[model samples]
Target: MDELTLRIYPSVRAAAPDLETPGLAGYAFARHAWLQAWADTFGAQAHIEPAIVVMAGVRIQMVLPLGITRRNGLRTLEFLGGIVTDYNAPAIDPDFARSLDATAVQALWRRITAALPSHDVVCLTRMPVTLDPPEGAVGERVPNPLALLPGVNAAGQARSVTFPDRYEALTGTLRPRFWADTQRCRRRLAEVGPIAFVVADDDAGMRALIVSLKRMKSRRWRETHSKDWFAVPAFSDFYDAMARIDLPEGRIHGSSLNVSGTAVAAHLGLVYRSRFYLLLIGWEADGWRRFSTGRLMTETLLRQAFDEGLRVFDFTVGEEAYKDDWANALMPLVRYDEAITARGRFATVLMTARDRLRARATQVAWLRRIVRWLAGRPLA
Candidate 1:
């Protein structure tokens, strides 16, 4: 109904001056404070270029927090938060978003992409089909406009569990055997000593728990021979800063499962929009492994979520087998990739080939062994 124009801003703050206003509606990750934290920590390496869509040359309609980086000699455009951000979507005005249909959204997307600065490839990932309204907002879920565009493909699935009126009712939804096993684990863990689940209530406590989480996670990654993103200073810094961020609708939540006054497992997450996002989790790997501390930690968190009147407990991304035991719903994630130059197309082909190879390696043991041998890495 109104003329739309796209403008590029060099930073997240410049793009949305009213970022902290309660009127902003979007997921927690798309919040200005979240994106700005990423920009501040990762700005040394990536260039932050956020695209803002304006309505009637006055009102801000949407903000696409994008960034550019030179990888393998080609400048590439992508969402600002990269792999750390679970759900990537634009912070759009709800009224404007509801007015646009698929056709109109696609046209607007094309215009936005065309106006972007010169780059080789545009890759936007981990977008959900629909966005839940902010905490206390009264409305149905809004359709994610980017998901309606062509060329989007299924990236993966994010798992979550919706809470019931009662915590016991939520537990009843799980398999009888699984719940029994979780309870057994709790009993076994308590035998070691008094078991308690603690949440960080102050900034000092939050930072301490985050530090413990990082130590445990890094150790686990090292033992498994996996690529440790936390080893990267920027990645670690981004998460550390996020743990301290305080927003009206969202706040960093850190908790630990303690045994005998010692924390054996820790989790760093976000409490936003009546949901608890299970982001980073780590557990003691030594003697506590036999007690299943990780599962116990998760159970404690779920109970706390219920007590707090949270609507959902989101496991975020990945298809880890443990998620299947507790997840009652799975949200499909999608990505859009487009190449603007020969280099970009070549990169795209390489990515596809690599994915295929990885998929095949998972199925064929010999191939996997050979690949590992060639790469001079041990099996994970």
Candidate 2:
């Protein structure tokens, strides 16, 4: 076995060339284009320091897209894409990933963390257990090294609907009543005018759909009094850049449900590695709400996924009830939280307590309602 060495880069753009090499298997979020877009948009607000780990006798083993952000005098090390990135794991060579055991992974992490820039705490979240190769790539799914770390806890779970051999089989997985309701909604929606599910195939169409998405999402956030990420210029820029990014393995996919030549519901997602990552979705909040355009759009997309022979329709990270209603498989996400300094230790303790309180609230109906009410969220 060769010795493993770590190198840190000031920005992802500087590391972009190295990351384009073949044989790397990971989520689209870990790619250079994605990370670079994030850095280009949020660099002024956050400090990005990407690290590459290599085997001395071999080639590049992993690329860690990391960044630091200070809040209330405490610097927190996190994955570069911040709130937008659903999954946070290194883009690693499959061979290198398979070669490591639990002990070796820990040792590698220790070396990598030691080389990271000064920070009060390291908080890595939404990591999956395995990294599957992209479609047409010759490799098996490999274990995610970060998920093997000791003391890692279940942060949350991502939901995905696995396609069956036949598209009709999908309905059997969902509640009969829910499936019927969607069909009813589809019929009602069609009664208004001609209904169609359209995909943005050109740059102009893509931009138009994105604009509609932002508008719908903005209105929704305002109605619910929720924090609107799209309102932030940097976050908006990052998403716009992603939608325009063109890559071989995967690219941003924008689609909408059009009725009488008007887009009423829209979705912006990624089609990567035979999976459709459902990232952003919004529906017009008008009389159309009674038509359930959002639900119809979801069903239409699932059918599209089946027609395209895609394997998974990933709902990304969320605990929403609608996702649970559609998802057949639940991918458990884990987190690695560590304190590097005295202040970090205190912060970690506080974080743990906060997590415990949140968990408790989830288990108690009244407490959960109160929590949602206080946060200005709708109680269902």
Candidate 3:
């Protein structure tokens, strides 16, 4: 933990470390092995921004393949937060994880000073506290996190709700009327047309449904004049592959809400460790006005899950109103960032300046409208 006397060096490669290492899951996503996959597949042009946090004659942690971009002459390094990956903390031993924060902070600062010695800005986005703060003013940049993280420590969370057992336990949290309404929706759906279910397995039928869902989502986004998550080819592939990722390790349950043998809505979720995490969803535009395709799809999945004996049903991060009816528990997602060096400090300052201006603009009702409109677009 002292002045990293060990000759630790930094590399931008994303290779996997020893399996016997302490925190493999934490660093795997950020390592070269994972980042290269993202680079090749996601076209995530990045620098080989590498750093080795070594100790005890072994390589403990490695940080690599981060995007280093200069904006307005500010040399800023983003934490990457594995934009295309997840689990962005250091992988070290239990004992080592305890001392990792301090060692990592010093090592990171040294690397930033050495790599772009003149650059005085490091901007870490959506980083876990386990990564350790660089000891300065910390603030939320975009406020709403770019990605969702399932916080295990929901007890301390303000919006935390109790986790319900799968099946009735979840829907039981809602009003009795809500359950009756669900029954009514089912009856109405039956009255209007036949309802069917298509699950994404390895079969051609499943693959076809996934493809149709993608096309449906793309068209929906275009008609609404909004950007879609799968607009990029890599993301589209990710969406498709997602339907397959859990099948081998655990189980993947991607369902299509169909009517009269025709697909009306689709629910794409990842089922792991007896928990169903709602990922992305799509619906047929025509049926939306008649019957809430999205919510109905949830009911479909919920009943299916209960029948299958699944325990937890996570709606993921958003505090969206619709999730309330089915979510027996509410988990509030939080955002926090830390600057680790002279580089981090300056970047934080620049963000502060920009956000202040935005905040003032939002103070005026009329101006707020424009601010929201512009923000929906892209900001450098």
lDDT of all the models against the reference?
Answer: 0.81, 0.81, 0.52
For residues 1-380, write the lDDT of model 2, one tens digit per residue.
43665677776777776656556778888777777777778765665554444333367777777777775467778877877788988777787888888898888877777777788887888899888674566756778988988889998888899899998888987789989988998888888999988999999999999999999998988898998888899989987888888765887889999999999999999898788988899999779999888888888888898899898899989887889889998888899888889988887776676557678998898877766665633211
Q: What does candidate 3's lDDT look like per residue over 97-138, in tens digits?
A: 443343464564455346543444554443433321111214
The true-versus-predicted C-alpha distance at residue 125 of model 3, in Å, is: 3.9
TM-score of each: 0.89, 0.89, 0.66
In order of listing, the candidates' clash counts read 0, 0, 18
Error of 2 at 215 (Å): 1.0
Arrange candidates by lDDT, descending: 2, 1, 3
Name the regions of candidate 2 deviating beyond 4 angstroms.
Answer: 49-57, 137-140, 350-380
Query: Best candidate per lDDT, number?
Result: 2
- What lDDT is reached at residue 171 by model 2? 90
Clashing pairs in 1: none
The TM-score between candidate 1 and the true structure equals 0.89
Angstrom error of the Cα, residue 357, model 2: value is 7.4
